[model samples]
Target: MHKQRLVIAGSGSTYTMGMMMSLIEEKENFPLKEVVFYDIDEQRQERNAKATEILFKERYPELESFSYTTNKEIAFKDADFVFVQIRTGGLPMREKDEQISLKHGVVGQETCGPGGMAYGLRSIKDMIELVNDIRTYAPHAWILNYTNPAAIVAVALKQEFPDDHRLLNICDMPIAIMISYAKMLNIDVWEIVPEYFGLNHFGWFTKIYDKSGNDHTERLKSRIIDEGFTPEDTEIANDVSWQKTFEQARQMLMDFPEYLPNTYLQYYLYPDQMVEKEDPERTRARQVIEGRQNRVHSLCDGIIEKGTAKDADLHVDIHGVFMVKAAASLAYNLNERFIVITENNGIISNLPEDAMVEVPALLTANGPKPFAIGEIPTFYKGLIEGQYAYEKLVTEAYFENSYQKLVQALTLNRTVISPDKAKAILEDMMEANASYWPELN
Candidate 1:
């Protein structure tokens, strides 16, 4: 197998260090010839790149070249795989996305309600631009995107590049949740083969089976209901809001026991509860900035100051592990099974074929080969269809610059079902995102 040249598009992200650690762990399977960090923010990416360069020197010195740059052509030229995790407006803009929605008496989340809609609009423009740049710079490179508001971004990209098989949009939330389930079941996460379906964050795990083919879906569901739930990541447990999100998954399961619900569904399934619990003064974005953002950068700063990464404390968690594993599957043709967001195309018999739905897929050299989920029940179908409509409308709204379509999108979102509330939130969002979003007519 030919060695690969990998580029991290959002090298400045807090998750960058973790991703590097994962790459190191999977080096045997996915060998690297070079690594490049690309970001629009020079200072931020430099911080991560400088630290990563030291770590690479100490840990995996086999790499022939390592560099970071703000230039797209320099970062992407001849890359075999591009791992994208860019944040269009950064954490400050995300804070506004949440704060504005909360001020309007609706659920405020990073990727689920009005906040997601706002983030989605801004993300589509940059993501489309990034894709085009990749095509120009490295036409044969596989683009594995981990950008948030992925459902909306996926739909926008699908509409923009329908036949492009090199791009794969994925989320690690399912993997995160499965890690927790593995802990609950007292087994390694890899031992569990899961069957899942739905939109990005708004999905469900229909079944989980051990390698021996023993069904543990009901057993794990019972455990969650009996003992409550929490993510496997200790950092997430430190946040009160994330704790509530995991706990709410138990409640969602009790109310509808058909399948285990994704924790993000808490925003849509119980909007009022989420809204009431949210502190307008401090949202998840603020917590992340105060917590993970600070910790990752501080660690990098320490490594830089010491001029060595011998004592660096960067931990490899689900985010990094999931990304590298997904990339390696494609790079080495490992055919690893992962849950990815891809074009539906009759995967779900009831949903629109063009909708980008999340389902189990075999990550091969060709791209994600999604499993056929046949037909979901009416309850799941209805919820997925409504969310799909919202995603489609958001995509349409961005391309057409139609304020009315955005209003419809938000109105259809479960968190902001009322047109009055959607418009109120939309007006505030429009003002807050004036500099980022396109001028909506």
Candidate 2:
């Protein structure tokens, strides 16, 4: 059992604390020789780094070194797995992303519509740069990305590093949704075997079979429609916005009962409803800042002030655990099944071969071997093609720095079907993201 050296790329995030906590909890399964925190924002990372140091000292005083750094060479060098979760412009820009989209009567989400396109443009620059550095330094290291607007970032990375199977793109939403499904069925999450397909955040669960090999999809759908749905987690379950999201999931299932749709589909399927529920004065970014961000930072402040993590109240959530599980599946060849983002390559037979699609795959040492989802129906194919085009256009717009391409992408997006509205949102987003995005001419 060779212990791995892990590097968390975006250590400044509120999620880092949970990830560190998760690492400590899962140490026996995915043992580490070292753990390093790497982030560009020194001030933000310092708080998390200091708190993590305290937690590690008391909880994980194990094999070897633990450190945090801003230097890529120091962080990436000799690492076995790099968990990438960088937020390019951070929450302030995310607030702008939401507010800007809302100003134009579109879905104001972090990773959908015009807002996602803005965030996608910013993420490509940083993710590509990070991948290039990983190649230069830890050439053999596996890159597990948990970045938002994953559909766009995945496409961009595939275009640049087509053969880099070590770079795995994953999302936690499907896992979280499954948790809710298990709760509905009164069973453990692992007992449910899910068959899912689509792009990241924009997908659906085609089938869910229990350990007994019994199809529970229709049963779960009836439960959701009858009783509504909520995330099984305490923190997310209590969120007002998330509550509405689940409610919308129920509504979606009632309207289109063939398959259970991902909660995020609400934004595209009913943009007006999503927009109506939002408070333009305080978007999801602001909610995160006030909620999780403040909670984690405050915990850090407490840990630092006491100089001990004995009383630290950091809660490990599925987001962090899922990332570690993905890495472990690769490290130990567990062949664990997960819904991950991978090149379509005919996984969805009707979709473009090059389009990056989300589907269940067995994560092994070689990489994720995606299951074949032979052709889909006309309704799903039409929706997926349109969304895929939007995602591809966003990636192309970033690489070419073409404002026209971005406009085309937004126009194609379901949330903003009007070319004029797309132009309006793009112009606002361009000005808001001027500091982060490449100059689009």
Candidate 3:
């Protein structure tokens, strides 16, 4: 077995510990000769680096080597796989993105509506830079990107590096949803194979087959319609906000019973309801800052003080583990099927060939081979087309630095009802994100 060198781009993130634990758990299958952590923030990265040192020394003494650095060349050199999970402006700017949109009466979410557009523009530039650096330093390395506003980032990457087969864009929301589905059906998640399609955050599960080839789509749909998407037991549903998002799947089913909808569709299909539920003063970003952010930092501080993570209260992020599995599948050519974000290329006969769609694909050493979903229903087609237009325009706006395209993108969003409201939100976002976003004409 050839040991691999892995690089994690946003090593300072709260999710890094979970990812480290995941690598520890799967070390037998995906042996790592070296692990490099790279982040721009010196203070935060130092804290995380300290915690990581404690974790490896206490838990996995057999691991060959591990280190953290701000040097891109050192981090990216000779890496077999580079996992990218960056936040361009971090949480403060994310808070601004949400509040600014809410002030204009739009659904204030980190990965949907106007907030997503704002995040997308910032992410495009940063992601492009990361891609370029990775290609330069480790030309043959596979870049498994789990960056947020994934749909837009995927589109921008497709436009920038149309021939770069090594770049694979993915999200864990579908995997989280599948875990819930597995709990609902009283079966192991790995025993179920799903047929799903749409852009990131906006998608549907059309079919779910058991290991015995039993089609359970109707059964799952009936349960969701009657009792909402309440899973019997899953870590993702533990949070009150996540629980509510799961239950809202009932409303989406009621509106369109043809397929099981992604929880994020609530933002698009019921923007008014989303607005009603949001608290402008304390948006989701603030909640994360108060919750996960504080807790993770405190844990890091404790690890540094004790010089050991043996008694630390670190929790595993099942979502982060999914990315590890993806990397393993690619490195070993497991050909495991997963939902990935890739160019449509007539996969959906109804949608544009250039749009980046999330669908099931067989992961191979060569990269993801997406399964064709054919044509979708007219309702879904229309919704997907509208959202894709907004996503594509966001990429265009970033590349062209065209303020007109930026406004047009906001106006096309389901949350924004008029050009005036779009303009207001765009101006506020521009002012708030002045330091991050490119100057637009």
What range of 10 consecutive residues in model 2 has the weakest lDDT sum?
226-235
Question: What is the model-wide C-alpha lDDT for candidate 1?
Answer: 0.91
TM-score of 1: 0.98
- lDDT per residue as tens, model 2, 1-441: 879999999999988888888898889989999999999999999999999888998999994888999999999998899999999999998999999989899899899998899899999999999999988999999999999889999999999999898999999999889989999999988788999999999889999999799999888888888888987865598888888788889999999998899999999999888889888898999999999889888999999999998867777788888899889999999999989999988899988999889999999999999999999999999999999999999998888889999889998999999999988887788888888898998
Residue-level lDDT of model 3, residues 1-441, one tens digit each, is 778899999988878887888888888888888889999887888888889988998877887898999999999988999999999999998998999888888899999989999999989999999999999999999999989999999999999999999999999888888887887788988788999999999999999998799998888888777766764333455567888888888888887888888889999999999999989888999988888788889989999998889889876566667888888899999999888898899999999999999999999988889898998999899999999999999999999999999888888889885899988888889888888899999
Q: In candidate 1, how many Å is residue 277 off?
A: 0.7
Off by over 4 Å in 2: none
lDDT of each: 0.91, 0.91, 0.88
Model 2 TM-score relative to the real fold? 0.98
**Regions more than 4 Å wrong, model 3:** 231-235
Q: What is the lDDT of residue 7 in candidate 1?
A: 94
Question: How many pairs of residues collide in model 2?
Answer: 0
The C-alpha TM-scores of every prediction are 0.98, 0.98, 0.97
